[model samples]
Every structure is written in structure tokens, then in C-alpha cells.
Target: MDKDWIAYSECVWQCRSNNESSHQTIGSSQAFSVNMASMNEPASTTASTTHQSQTEARTTSSMPNITQHSLDHNPDIFTIICCNDSFQIALDHSTIATLLRVCKRVRPLLSSKVPRFHSWWRNVGLWRPNGSLRFALTPSEQIALSLHCEYEGIADRSWLDNQADQGNATALFFLAWIHQIDLDSQQSVNKPKREAICQQIIFYLEKAAQADHPMAQYDLAGCYRNGLGVDQDPTKAVDMFRSLAECGIPQAQVALGGCYENGEGVDQDYDTAIEWYSKAADQGSEDGRLHIVFLRGWFSFIGHGVEQSDADAFNRWHEVSTNSTNPVLKPIATHMVGWMHYLGRGTVQDKPKGVNIIRENRSDEFPLGESESLAANWADINSDSPALRKFLGMCQFGSDHEWLCKHLVAVCLIHGFGTRQDQEKAAGIFEQLANEGHSVSQLWIGRCYSFGKGVSKNDEKAFEWWSKSANQGNSYGQWMVGCCYYSEYGVTRDHTEATEWFRKSAELGNRYGQNMLGDCYKNGCGVTKDIDTAVFWLRKAAEQGFENAIYKLRQLDQWL
Candidate 1:
């Protein structure tokens, strides 16, 4: 009923009006002004309360006090499980409160049956501890959440202030989250506007964290960790991580594990570090598993509380590279293993084998979206995307897998992927790897010799390289060798030899080989013609969506 509340409302409207460029609702202040220009209430006044009584309440009682139910839903566990994180992070605003005001917690039958120990409430806004959130939108919060300042749901400063006054921890965090969203980096800001925004965030985060809001506490730890709003205190950061870690938060567990490993706040305790990492790893935390494995490798040679041995270190890193499927960690570990092998520090000196280890590790994504039977091509990778830049950098360094790096560089040269296209350089690189007995490179060099792509077209040289790769069990190479034998490109036409090579490739699941073998059978080039057998082989290739196989099947009038 006091003028202070009215004065505050006016101030908020004035501020909102000034911030029109921020894309907030333009004239909401004027509309709200007429309805709430009086002494006490805006629209939420005494006159609106006595209209109806709930079945659970006395007829004389105003509105039934509903138990705290939340419309503020957040993501689950850790997306660092990635819905698991991506989906939850995308769930910032919007609610089902519009369609039905009946929230899950408001359903008396459900509420009594199951206890909702939701962690999402701590991250989002509005809890049952005020109004009901229907299955659709707006216990008023749906309105606040689903809109910007454009509609009734907009959580402008005044709305959040009111919710915060009502002891809404989520509201407090939201006020902070939305304000500093633009300046997401927690560095000390120089501009007055940014400084003010940072200060606002600190104010709300501190208040909400004090109220024991889980998200607020999580962010508060970040502040200390980054020295943003609070003075940098490794001890405080450690304390916060320890608290959340105990609550079964995987991110907190990893953070605490890192702190222990690095001696950030406590003495170096590798055992304790491993313990926290194991806990997080149990919850499927990749960082936790990675740290545990990395720690073993780090101290294996350093003699930090463990017996130092070069071989032991190499084994530890090799285990990581061989066992892990993580895209980032696996390559790093594999590189470490290759380097150790090359240096002859941990294992026997075998430079070619060391290079070969990296060479074989790139079966997956070697061509990286090039569609020509897993070979490199003219797919556009020239954009300054982060992934492309990182990939190009990795290829340039050649630190972890030298031969693998050369192969990728050759691919880049051929396709101009994040670099200049140079057919000659690519052909040279392929020839080098082919001499090193790299099967894929042997196949590529064969193609280069056959097509004169940076090299003289020579069927004999192409047939020679293809034979080498085919001997090493490259399926595509077998098909190429078969082609050379059938076409008499480098030697006399030998149908039996061509048919045998095609059979070998077909058995290894090469669609081209299957199609060719079927054709050989159909024409009796190397064996007696058998229409049924030819149909079987052609159908197999056709099932894999090979275009040539489908055409052959159509020519034979076979079911495809």
C-alpha cells in the first residue's frame, strides 16, 4: 500500500523505456502505468482474489495456497552428458503452463504418490513453493518465461524483483544470467556499461548463492575460479567444488579432481585426485575418465609419488590411445605414443613403425565428408570455421602422427581444404607413403599414375602400386588390380586373374568388386556363366545402393 513500491515500479518502467533498443516491449510501461498508478497493487490486487474457492479450500478463503510446484525446468545431470546438455541449455525459456494450469505437483494424487526431488528448479525459475504452472503456460510464469517484454510473461526487472522478493532463488539467478549474457566471458571489464553489468551479476549471484540455490552456487564457484566478481581464491574455488562434488555433481567432481591434481588449494594428492575422478567417471564423465588416464601417464615418467619409468609412461599413454574413442583425447594420446616410439625412449627404436602407428589410426573420417568411396575430393573446407582451422593446424604440426599428418595434408592439397590445392604435392605425398607401405596411399598413388594427376599417366606404374595395396588387403586396391587385369592396361588380358581379384574384393564387402564379379560370371570371362550366381552377386551390390549394380540388375531383368 506504500508509495515506495509505486515509486520503484515507476523507476523500472522509466528504465525499460530507455532500453528500447534492447528489443524489449516498447510501450508496456504506459499500459502498466494506468492499471497500477494507484497506491497498493498492480493487477494482482484484493478485488481479484474472492471470485472462486477451490474444492480443497473453505468457500470464504480467498485463493487456495498451492504447494510449491515448478514451471522452471532445467536440463538434467551434466551435459559435459552433451541431452543431455545441448537439449537442457536450449530449454532456457518456454513452458507448458498455457494449456493447463494443473502442474504435476499440483495434481493432489500425483504429489502424494511421488516425491519430486527436482534439481531443475534450482536452475530455472518459479517453484511450487507460489503458484500453479499448468501443462501449457502461465501460472503467470508461463507468460513471464515464454515472452520477452512483449507480452505478460516477460521477466523484466520488475517481475524478477517481485519474484525475488517472494524468495525465488531461480529468479535471483535469472536476473544475473540475463544481464551478463552478452558479456559471458568472466574477465574484468573496462567499459562502464560492462562493469555495471558485471556488478549486477555479482549482486544477484551472491544473494541467490546465499539462499543455497544449486545453480547460484555453481556460478559463484566460477566467479572465484575466474576471479570475475570475487577476488581469485583457489581455496574458495576448491571449497565450492568440494561441496558440489559431495552432492554427486559430475562437473564438480571433475573440478575438484583437477584442483587436487594441480595442488590448487591443497597439497598434491594423486590418490585423492584419482578417487574424485573415479567417482565422476562412474557417472559417465569423460573429463573424469580422461583425467584419471592422463594422470597415470603424466606421473609415469615424472616420478611424482610414483616410480619413474619411461616404459611405464609409454604403456600408459598407449593404453589411452588404443582404448579411448574420444575424438580429442585419443589423437593426443596416440601422438604421445608415436613420439615415444620414435625417440626410442620408452620402447624399441622403430621409426617406420612409429610413423605407421599414426598412419593406421585415421581409418575414420580420413576423407572427412568426401563422398567418392571414402576418398578426398572438392568439398568446401575453406571457410574459417573453428573445426577446419583446428584440423588444418593438426595436419600442419605432424607432432603426434607424422605420416597421418602427411596424408591429411595431401588430402588438403588435392581438395584445397583450408589450403591451396596442389595436385603435384598431393601426388608426391602419396608416393612417399606408398613407399612406406601405406595401403591407402598405394591406392591413391595408383590413381595418380593412372590419371596423370600431378604425375605422368603410366598404366604399368598404376598396376604396380595397385598390386602392392591389393597384396596388403586394401579392398579398393583389389578392385583396381582386377580392372587392370581385365583391361590389359599394363599386361596381357587375364580373365582368370581379374575374376580372382574381383572375388577377393567382393568377399571383403566392396560394392564395385561385387558388381564386377557378377559381370564376369554373366559373360563367362574367367568362369562358366551362371545367371543365378550372377544375380545373387549383383543383388548384393545393389542392396548397398551401388548405381552400377542397379543398372546391371535392370539389364538382366533381375529383382533389385
Candidate 2:
């Protein structure tokens, strides 16, 4: 018989149990005998079934010749047949039932021969409800499938432990990952439990690393570097990072660059660091790009690894300010940009615009006003040291609280509190805040301009800021405006304007304002000459211990 006919005959015989008894056999007994003879005959002669069944006894005698031993002894013939695509397709449910019915010996032999049957099932997208391909199989069969499938349901701790005990590298790596995740999640775990978990993670990670798992190698190196369940070994960490960097892992490249930059485990080499950082940046690593920018800027600024160039520093900072998405770095970069602009370092000096940019980008939270009780006890709180207030203010600044932080920083700059006194910086900060509508800052800015503490003395600027503060109803600002008018500091000497501002300040109970108003009345500079009104204002100032007012009153009393 032809090989195709024999395979078809075997399928029909095996599938006999699936059909009604009437449809069990595919052809007459004579045809089966003739086909069986054709298997043994030479290629030249064809076995004719029509007259072969004339003797029923001879046809029945050929049935026992097709035994299991005949097929099993020449198993390669069956193997070739079964390995065919058509054979596999035909070996479905009904065919399997038929094969079992035709000969029980064939089933066990096929099972032994085709050990990857479950793998084939998986390859064909067959999945059980439990995610195991061997759903209908016994526990032993499931275990056999698990060895090859690596299914998620089969990856419990117990199974992984067993596999790891048997030296399965993949199982060891997965076990390490599981333990690491557990340790990270249970922060409040007991010390002993945490240490135990860490040790297990290290043990498995090391085993997997030895097995050449790249992620395990990276993680194990980190453990060594940090002394987590391992001795601190910077050399080993550097070696691992170097290996992975050669493999083009971006994170490893960055780590290797850091090692070169800091001389942690090797000689410090700026060229090597830059090379590795560039490699990581090419791979789209943000930290790599940031480090490159920072390193280049620092080197350019100090002429260390590169020639000093403020323009290069400015370009790097400008890029960070404009393009970086990091919240903290962006603001810091913006501040640097403003500083460069103000100092004319690689940029034209534009103090007003520079200060404005810094003020706008700086933090917005006002920490000082957050607590009313704290504000009430400010004097007592700051009595310990002159620098205490400055330190507290910088803490707020570092925490991105801008309003009170700027005020305190300016105060520090003015008084050399906890830092070098920089009158120009102080004045700039005050001016920025003043423009932002801070009444107190406006008063300070006016004072700075009036006294030339930082910038050259400019009386008109002083009056302008003081006038803004006064309009905001600041009593000190009103008094300063009066002083400006009285001294013709910015505006023309206008005693009437001075008296009006002094009266406004006096009504608000400012001692200096009361004294100034008394003087205006006594001299008839603005108000009508009225000794009684002058005496009233002077007494008010005297109550507040204004010595000039008291001395003026003593002279007036002696004259009276």
C-alpha cells in the first residue's frame, strides 16, 4: 500500500471508537488485506483487492500480521509519518481515541517519543483556564510541562526553590527579583527578617550573575557597591559596570562614567567620563545628558578640563533652564541665567530684567506667614544668634519657599549674616520683591537707593519706591516719603507735601511722623503757625520717647 493510504488506514482504525458501529471500518476486509500485502511487496507489482478476498480465510489471516511489534520494531518509519504536518493535523481528538482503541501499546510509545507534545499545544495557542497547557494531564505530566513552559502559575516560591536547588539559572534570577521586591515593599519589617530576605536576594542574584544574566549582574554589583548583603567592593562594582557598559547598557554606561569622574575604583579621567556620558546620552538617558552639561559647564567655568569660557557655562545653563523637565534643576538654572545676565558674564548686563527673571522663576511659597504663632515670637526665636534668622531663611529657600526666603536672603546680604555681605545683591533682591508688590521690600529698596548701599545714590528712584509703598498704606513708607519731600531728596523741597505725608504717618502713630509734623507746625513750613497744634504733636512724639521732640518741647515751655 502507498504510505499515505497506510497512514489513512491507521487513522480510520484508530478513530473507530468515535463513530457508530455501522461506520467503524473504512473499506472491506479484502481491501485492508490487499493494502497490508502492498506494504511488503516490491515496487513493480500492485496488489489488486477485487479478487484477493475470494478466500475469506486468507484475508482474515493477514489481520494478525499488522501487529504493534511490527510498527514499534521499525519505529523510524512511524516517526517519519507522525512528524509530517498532515500527520500532526490528523492526530486530533478523534484520531487519538482511534489510536488508543486500535492498540494500547502505541499510546505509551507515542507519549515517550513525543515528550514535547504540551509544548506543541502551547505553540498552537492552546491554554487552560489555569494558564497551564497540560490541563487534562496528571500531576506528573504537569511537572513535565512546567520544566519547558516556565508558565507564571508554575513559578510559585516553592517551585522556584526546588528549581533553584536543582541549579536552574533562570529560576534563581526570578527568585532574586521576588525577594528584592518583597524587601523593598516591607520597609517596617523586623531587622532579622529584612536581613534574611536581603541575604536570599544576594545569594540568588550572585548565582544568576554567574550564569551570565545581565540584569542579575547589574543588581549584584549594586549590592556590592552599597554593602547590602555583601561586602562593600567598589572594584567589583566598577568591573561589572564596565562589562555592561561595553554591552551598551545605558545605565551601566552612566555608572561607569561616574566611577571615572569620581575616581571611585579607577584613576579619575575626565576624557573617559565624557566618553561614557556621551554614549549614554546617545542612548537617550536623561541623567547622562544632565551630567554632560554640568561637567562641561563646570570645566569651562574653572578652566579645569577645558578652557575657561563663561559663554559655554551660560549656554549649558540656558539649555537646562529652557529644555530640562526637572522641576528643581529648571528653577536653579533660571536663577543662574539671571545671575549671568546681571553680572554681564557671557551676556549683556540688564540688572532690572535679570532680577525680574530670577524673581518670577523662584519658589512661590511664603513659609514665614504660614504660622501666625511663629511670626508673633520672631524676636524671641531669633535671639540666640545673629545668623540664626539667615540660616532659617536659607532653609526655606532650599525648600523652594520664595517670598520670605528672598526677604531673609536680602537681610543676610545686607548684614553679612551667615554669608558674605553683598550690598548689590541685597539691593537687587529688594528691588525685585518691591516690583512684585511687597510693601516692606519696596521700603527697603527705597532705602538702598537713598543711601547708595549697593547702586549709586539715586534720590528719584528712592522716592518712586517709597511712593509705591506709601500708596500701599505702609506707615514707614509714608514717613520716608515725608523725609524725601522735606530734604528735597528726589522731588523739589515742598513743605506742604512733607506736612501732608507726615500728618498721614502721624495719624498712624509713627513717632518720627509725629515729631516731623510738630516741626512743620512750629516753623509754619506747611501748616498755619499754631503753637498749640505743634505742642500737641510734640507731646505725642514725647510719649514715644522721641528725644528731639522732648528737647523741642522743653525749649518751648521755657519760652512760654
Candidate 3:
């Protein structure tokens, strides 16, 4: 039997037959057959009558005998046959090639094996002969069907290397996995060969996993589960995850449980996916943990995977909510907890605590370590230092800091951080820094003038300083500049310009900008009337505690 035909035939049989053993026997080659039949389904249908009218193309090569063993060893035969039934139901509406392409995994293999008679290699970066993906295959017919497995394997390796170089961790992981699978080869590798490829796969997986690649974690777990390349130590794989688990990798935690739950490389004990799911849940990997919860619950409810205990599943799900670090799941867990309390699952029904938990878990506070610390230190050191004391007199005497820091030192004299307090020195420093085009210092100086923090009140001077900072994309300066434009303070009134600055600030997630943007939208000042957009902006600002925005949102909602 032709290998391709046998694979395809197996797919057909697999789809129709419900034999479990028969299905498992149909191996990798079956995937190819299913792919070919799928791809050509629609074409075959549209040209059904014509297909038969035209005689089958004759070839001089001897036909291979179809055998039961061949059909029994491929996934393609089963899947293809299943698709055949589906195609018959909608034959006129679908194209065979289109259907075949749906099975993405088998498409390339099928394409490689097809006999190409009149094809050209022109395209790059894509499959198909005219497209990229050059395979070393010969054409016995119109399609290129004589591809060598070694050539494909080399291509796979190259593809994986390219993906890794491009920093696509997921692709890198899958490519390594494909290498491990080695579907094209029939013989089991010698110990040396197997170890070499497996070692390469482990290297690729390690690189990807360190880069927080999800698929890499999943496959790495599988490797640990099966003891492929490394020693069959599930505990080592689980131990590989201190960093990943803490860094919020959900899949890693799931894999880590294998060691704990089965005691494969650790101690065997049933944890029911609860402990791992809790860790994953906290990292916003609720989807992954949800699968665990479902299985655990199903089993406990009737003991499918574990001993029967409806209470155990219920309690596990509760933990999935309260202990989860994922904010999205917090709300779902909150609701579940509320329902559980209402129904008296375990704890007394406490609606208020559940509500509070949901509110608290909506969004985790991002750490203000590097950026905030830098900004604050810069603020403090610049405002303090004894060197600023000597400079203050010189600054007042029309002398200035040789550099921006000198000016900041003078401001420090006025601010009394390291020098005797003197507003005059501070004002002088502000003048120097603002004139030097230091955006942050300019905004600060503008703020001082606007609020009369250290200088005589001056709106015009404030606007000038704000304008300079706004030009450099300072968020606060942009906000003030927008205010100036909108209020026509020391400038021409232009809502369009106000809106422009507002949009710039809003893009940076500034609450003040969000508020102004909502106002602009509401009044049709600089933008077209957009009630929805206005509401959205207002809500964002309100969430950030912008009082005016909150008031406006409430009024607008009432109107709606």
C-alpha cells in the first residue's frame, strides 16, 4: 500500500471506528495522510465528476503494496478518514486543500511528500515550493513527495535556531520538542544518538524556560515525567523552578507538582493539584489552574482521579480564589466564595470579607523600586548638600552652577536640605535650571511659580516653564500646559492644543490628563463628541481618585 494512502485510510477508519486500541496504533505517519486528504477535500469535491473523467495520471514507478501494518501505524489515516465524513456533509461548500490546511501540524509534512511536477521556488519566509521552506525532496509526480527525513530534521534544527535567535521562546520550545519527538524516523535511536538529541533539546528548553517560555515549561515537565534525556529525576526538574515559580510562571508550578504528587523523584502523595494550582492561581494563571480544579473536583465528587470527596474539591476551588495571586481570578473566587458561604460549604457565609477580597485583588500594585527610587534620590540629593550653601550666594550674585547639579545645589540651599534655608537662592537655582532646558527641573520651577511655593506668584512665568518642560514630554508639564491652553492663561485659548497635550499625558496614564481628556470629549472641545470615550476616560480618572473626574462621571452616567 502507498504510505500516504494508508495513512489517509487510517485517518478515515479512526474517525469512523470507536476502537481505542486501534486508534493508539495509528502513529505519526497517520498525521501526514490526514493532512493530505484534508487539504484536497474541497478540490476533490468540486472536481469530483471531472476528477474521474480525467484518467488517473500514469507513472512508470512500480506501485507500493498497501498493507494492514502501514495503516495501523499512522495518525493521518484516522484523522483523514474522520475529515472525509465531515467533508461529505459539506462537500460542495469546502475546498479539499483548505480543509487539509486546518490540521497545521501535518500540513508541512504532507507538502514535503507531495510530488511536484511544475513548481518553482521563488517565495521566501513561508511554506509551499514557490514560497520559502526549501526541502530536499524529489518529484516522482507533479508534487515533491520524495523528501528525505534528514533534510527535514536539519531544517527543523535551523528553524529552531532562528526562532531562538529572534527571542521567540515559544517557537524555540516547540522546535526543541519536535526534535525530541523525531516523528520522521522509524527506528529507535542508539543510546548515543538519543542522548545527543535529547541533550540538545534540554539545552534549548533550558534557554526558553529561563526566558519564561510557557511551552518550554510544559514540555520540560513532560521530559521530567518521562525521563527522556537527563536522569529520570522529576525532583530535579521541580527544583529547577524556584525562580520561575516566584516570577509568576504558572505552568512551572504545575509541573513541579509531579515530584510532590507522585513522589517520582521526590515523595509520592496525593495533593490533588490544589497546592500547585494555588501557586499558579496567584500568578494570574487561573486558566491553567482551572483545569486542575475541574479534574480534582470531578474526581473528589466521585473519585475519578482521587478518593471521593465533594468537600475536598470545593475547598480546593476556594483556595484557588483566596490564595491566588492572579487578580482576575480573585473576583471569580470572590463570587464563588460568596456562593459557598451562602450555601455553607465550609466557612460561615461572610459576604463582606469576600467583597473586600475581590476589591483588593483587582490589580496588584507594581513595585516602585528602581524608577521611583532613582527619582526620589535625585530629588533628595539635589535638594540637600553643603556644597549648595556656598553656591547659593554666587547664584544670587548672578553666578550659577557650572552644571545642572550646581543649580540643584543652589535650590538645595533654598530648600534647607544641607544649607541654611534661603528662598532667594532657590528662586535663582530655578531660573538657572529652567533656562538650561532641564525638563524635570523646569516642571518643578513652573510648579513653584504657579503655587507660590518659594517665589512671588507668577502665572505667566509658570506657563513659560511649563511650555519648556511640555516640549520635552514631561507628564506634569504637559498637564499644566494643557491647562494653560484650555484656560487661555498667558496664551491664546485653543481647545485643540489643550486636547493634544491632554492626549499625550493620558497616553502615559496620568490621571489629570485622563480627566482633561474626558472633559474635552464631553464638551466637544478639541475632539468630536464621543460619550462612550468620554465615559471611559472619566472612569479611568475616577479610579485614580481624580475628584473632579469622579463628579463628572457620576453626572454623565445619570444623563445616560
Report lDDT (Cα) of residue 384, candidate 3: 28
User: Model 3 misses residue 98 by how many Å?
Assistant: 86
Task: Give all TM-scores, in the order shown.
Answer: 0.43, 0.36, 0.28
The Cα local distance difference test for each model comes to 0.60, 0.61, 0.51
Quote the positional error of residue 203 for candidate 1 in Å: 29
Better of 1 and 2 by lDDT: 2
Which lDDT tens digits does candidate 1 get at residues 212-308? 5555676788788757867888899899878777766666787788677657777867799899999999966777887688667756655556776
Arrange candidates by TM-score, highest first: which order? 1, 2, 3
lDDT score of residue 262 within candidate 2 = 60
After superposing candidate 1 on the true structure, give the runs of residues whose Cα lies further than 4 Å from its correct spot: 1-388, 399-401
Superposed Cα deviation of residue 371, candidate 2 (Å): 15
Alpha-carbon RMSD, each predicted model: 16.9, 25.2, 26.7
What lDDT score is found at residue 82 in candidate 2?
Answer: 45
lDDT of 3 by residue, 1-560 (tens): 35665565554344334222322576423322222232223221123433322212221122222233354577666446433433233211112232232233323333433323112212111234444233221111112112211233133345335546766544455456556556225266687877788788898887766544444655676676557666665666666543345444565565565345445566654463467757776755655566466435334534455565546756765776656554333333444344344334456655334333333432212111111111111232333222233223222322331333354454445446435666665666667777877675687677667767668888898899988988886665788899999999768999999999998887766667888999999889989989899988888778766689988977876333
Give the worst 10-residue stretch by lDDT in candidate 1: 33-42
lDDT of 3 at 504: 87
Clash list (residue pairs), candidate 2: 1-38, 1-39, 14-98, 14-99, 15-98
Evaluate residue 212 in candidate 3 and report its C-alpha lDDT on the 0 to 100 scale. 45
